[model samples]
Target: MEVTTNTQVNERELWGGGAKPFSASYGKIMMWFFIVSDALTFTGFLVSYGFSRFKNINSWPIADEVFTHFPFLHGIDAPMYYVALMTFILIFSSVTMVLAVDAGHHMNKSKVTFYMLLTIIGGAIFVGSQAWEWKNFIKGEYGALETKGGQILQFVNLENDKRISIQDFAIGINSERKTHKSNIGLWYQNEKTLPKITVEEVKKGFLANPNLTIRTEQISENGQKTLLSRDEAIYKIDDATGVVEGANLIHNEYGNRLFADFFFFITGFHGFHVFSGVVINIIIFFNVILGTYEKRGHYEMVEKVGLYWHFVDLVWVFVFTFFYLV
Candidate 1:
């Protein structure tokens, strides 16, 4: 009788030599390592943001109110529409990347090239959309007043239940005050560009517009900003110390300064990643056209980048949910 001896190899012990541990190539494994590390970094940022937001829940800005602008639809309330569109485009780009990688697997160079170009175009559109959103965020539409307590006060129309721009009602009081020039004043410090309307001007305007009421950043139990009575509004206007027209590291017209801070840091970091992925996709795109990967007899590079692109898309889902939806 001839008996066949079965060899049962220990998988972990066999892969302990640090080569293709999980049936993945060196480049693919390295890409996964990078993705895991990056995921942890993003997790930390979102957690910090979560804590900060919870600590100031009542004072936090409403996502719907703050992000209301849409491209070429001025004065129309399209709350979260543009942001939703951006998310959709990013997700679609991920789909294109998957197609590109699949095509590369079959050595279909033409199909790979087509899908990659689509992926790049989608990425570029998302990047451009983000810049537009940032522009609207930095250059606020309706201006606000900052109180001595470092909180902001917005103006909303009692008649229409909508926000009103400071410029629409602010009567420009003649000011003898001029922006300080270092040469004419203290030789060391030059004043930054002054706000178009002063706090005093906003106060004067508030007093004149009986239909306009003051809205504080503090959210009521009903989840709306605590609107002040006419008397309270008048009293609150007196606490105004400076004019706030937009968001910055220092102040935010929307609400708590921390919101803007986290928004810039987290979103900016993710934006950098998207921009980098686009650049990489473009490079691979050109190489596919030039038959470089075809000569190498494999398209592992495309698969590697596809992993990163998918990771980026997944990260944005969390970001959009926690930061915007929540």
Candidate 2:
């Protein structure tokens, strides 16, 4: 009589046993399935994003102006630097995850724990930095004027090519005692309103300042922005110092509503993923502390999470290319 032993039962048979529960290597299989599904989800999002980007053919905010913020420099014209740093942080975390898995192979608990800690730290820093980036983006810079056709027009100092802001043209006015004040008792107390400055004020300032020139947001790849000569710029406006009406999102001072929407959705989604990735890393970090994988004799958990970390990095590469470099 032939008897079946555990070793004799092939992996396929074990997993596909008649009316049997799946007996495959749980970690690796789950990791692969998760990755496949996640890939499809990301693909859907990116494709939809692409469709919107393509549909909005004429006017898009230049990614450079939209994301230009640098650390310690306050409000300098540094675009893509912070995100580049975040990208490196995620990539570095992936390396640490791999190192953690390698250490787990030799049952070196200390090394595994150390690398895992570093990985968690990297993920956290990336999320925080991303938050700052998003904050700056939503607030906007050099607040634009949107035309009826949905084009953005921006201000620039012609002599130096430095962009101008509404703040530069702002002449602070003294508020009356009857002026509306923010509610203090609300859960989110009153925030100070941004002082209003008119487009006319800006144009008048520009006229006075000969170095100033106006550039429309419709720029080509060659760095040529459709610009307005001083006469043309001042000519279009009935009131140079009066504020251009409407929010910057719909008919931005730059021109396209789609640009702001895409900026919010695409980068917002990517930032959300980064936030969730950090949360997952934190959970894995605690698992490492508890020696959960050590008991299993495999650090496949770390490897699985590592794959996710790398995937985030990979997505960012495409985003950077399309949004900035391209």
Name the best candidate (by lDDT). 1
Regions more than 4 Å wrong, model 2: 1-24, 56-58, 170-195, 199-211, 238-255
Per-residue lDDT, model 1, residue 248, is: 91
True-vs-predicted CA distance for residue 74, candidate 1, Å: 1.5
Q: lDDT for every model?
A: 0.89, 0.67
Q: List the residue pairs that clash in candidate 1.
A: none
Please list the Cα RMSD from the true structure of every candidate, rounded to 1 decimal place.
4.7, 5.2
lDDT of 1 by residue, 90-162 (tens): 9999999999999999999999999999999999999899889889999887889899999999999999988
Which residue runs of candidate 1 sit more than 4 Å off their true CA positions?
1-19
**How close to the true structure is residue 150 of candidate 2, measured as C-alpha lDDT?**
45
Which one is best on TM-score?
1
**Which ten residues in a row are the worst by lDDT in model 1?**
1-10
Cα deviation in Å at residue 265, candidate 2? 1.9
> How many clashing pairs does model 1 include?
0
